[model samples]
Target: MFESVMWLIVVAGGPLLLALLMAYVLMTRRHRGPAERMESDRATKRLYSQDER
Candidate 1:
């Protein structure tokens, strides 16, 4: 009985814990600021412009 209970906890709780952890990480992540975004856009544009040459 104890082994069965442990198995149940491991099977159910493992995914639950992983999902909660993933949610927390996704929710708490910081987005890039405007200056960083502009720099990224410029770099992308530069790369594409070079490809057109």
Candidate 2:
């Protein structure tokens, strides 16, 4: 009985631990910032005309 319970725990915990590891990896991935902030990041929220050329 004890050995069976331990085997069950190992089987169940393996997938659970894998899921948590995957979740952690996905949540920590780098993401793009807000669109407005990215647009205004250069000079005072304005894109320079000369910089365009």
Number of the predicted model whose TM-score against the real structure is largest: 1
TM-score of each: 0.70, 0.53
lDDT per residue, candidate 2, 1-53, as tens digits? 99999999999999999999999999999876798666667555355666676
lDDT string, candidate 1, 9-44, tens digits: 999999999999999999999999999999999999
| Minimal lDDT window, size 10, model 1 | 27-36
For all candidates in order, the CA lDDT equals 1.00, 0.83
Q: Residue 48 error for model 1, in Å?
A: 0.6
Lowest summed-lDDT stretch of 10 residues in model 2?
42-51
Q: Looking at candidate 2, what is the lDDT of residue 38?
A: 64
